[model samples]
Target: MNVAVEGRIEKRHISLSAKAKAYVALTKPRVIELLLVTTAPVMILAQNGIPDLWLVVATLVGGALSAGSAGAFNCYIDRDIDRVMKRTQGRPLVTGELTDREALVFAWVIGVASIVWLAIFANFLAAALSLVAILLYVFLYTVWLKRRTSQNIVWGGIAGCMPVLIGWAAVTHSLSWTPFILFGVVFLWTPPHYWPLSMKYRDEYKAANVPMLAVVRGRAVVGLQTILYAWATVACSLLLIPVAPMGIVYSVVALASGAWFIYETHRLYNRAIHGHEVKPMRVFHASISYLTLVFLAVAIDPLLPF
Candidate 1:
């Protein structure tokens, strides 16, 4: 009887773990990290070069809520395609962990809550931007572009770029060129950052009938585009030094890291030439590091003092 009781407890533990995974899936943690990276640097650059405590707390929470809602809605819309892709097969919608109605209601609640939180605690501009981000990601990217064109990632990148501008406006309550430049940094960074990973999973995207660049344009073309975008990202990063609070430390790191990122993309290009497939994964990993470090340099430049 003791052994039977222990087995039942273990079964309950497993059940709880599965439920927890579904809840976390609603948040889309990797996407949230990228959004925060974009948002935080702008917050650092706002007004006094240090974020207000209340504003920071409200923006983070509101941003997370909006991002989570977008992710959940995407899951709902892509349930069929998601089940076809191995990478997304385990998601709550695909795995039967949550009902469609349940996920829909959860997404709506989160979306409404995010806008209300931002309007009440932050400002109306931030709240409006948050709502716009959600609609752009859900309606523009997921509904209109994902299945139609290989340029989906390129255009969908706009939704991803919204957080930086939202962060800047949250404190100052208006838009400016500074945030526009930061948006450009993220906008240009998205294609190269996502394309190599798409190449690495081309078969999966093809299976899902998603018109990724790797599927429609071929890996060679995708590699070349990745390199071009990496170069553009570096150029954009350099432009920030003159406009924002960034300084020599950011410039130095941007040059070194950007060079390394370009080198990785070139390696990917060369590998694709020989019909080899593994180097794009390396390029993908490097892109993540490059973006994170560049933004970190931006966030800390005021403290560095040239």
Candidate 2:
């Protein structure tokens, strides 16, 4: 009987671990990291230095829950297509690690928690923006656009830009040109940042019948669009210098990083047009680094002495 009891205890421990992993998987932690990266830097720039530490923590925790709720809902809504897509085949829903009903319930629980958390700690505006982010990502992007339009990620990217506004609002409890410019910077950057990743997994998207740009258009057109958006993203970054009166460090990093980003995007276009090997993921990863550098400079320039 003792041996049987120990065996039951071990099984229980294993079951709990599996459930823990499943819950974490629903959050899509990597995407949460990207969202939060953009958040804290904006808070820094908004405060013109480091903001209150607890305020930053509260905003970040609230934002994480909101973003995670969006991700969980996305997983639930897309589970059918996810089963077909090779890239998403390992997701918790697709793998049977979590039930659809459980995911849906978890989504609402965390989503509501995010709003309450933000309202109590941040402000109504930030909380409201968090609600908007969840709603936009879920209703506008996932339910409405993902399968219907090739330009889905373009317009859907608006949800991602909400973080900049949320971050800024967390500090000043107001709107300003700076956050709008940063919003534009992120809005324009998303397609270039995401399209290449989609390009890498184009077959999966095609198999899933989702209307990614790569599915509906050839590489030449996709590459051209990436370059155009790269130009716009860089242009928007420059606007912050004048709008915020950012100093030399930010200006230099913005120009340099933006130039590299544009060059890599142009290289993607050149390769696609010339029938050479196009390194799509290289451009994708570079775009992430570019944004990190630009935002880091945003946070730093505010604190630096000219």
Indicate which candidate wins on TM-score. 2
lDDT of 1 by residue, 1-306 (tens): 012474563322336687678867966878998798878777887754678888898998999999999998999998899889998888887766777887898889999999999999999999999999999999999999999999999998889999998899899999988889879988999999999989878999999999999998877899999999999999998888888757887888899999999999999888887887556778888988998888788778876555
Against the true structure, whose lDDT is highest?
Answer: 2
Runs of candidate 1 with Cα error greater than 4 angstroms are 1-17
**Model 2: per-residue Cα lDDT over 87-137, one tens digit each:** 888888877777788899999999999999999999999999999999999
Candidate 2 wrong stretches, greater than 4 Å: 1-14
Question: Which pairs clash in the backbone of model 2?
Answer: none
- Worst lDDT run of 10 residues, candidate 1, spans 1-10
Q: What lDDT does model 2 reach?
A: 0.93
TM-score of each: 0.92, 0.95
CA displacement after TM-score superposition, residue 116 of candidate 2 (Å): 0.3
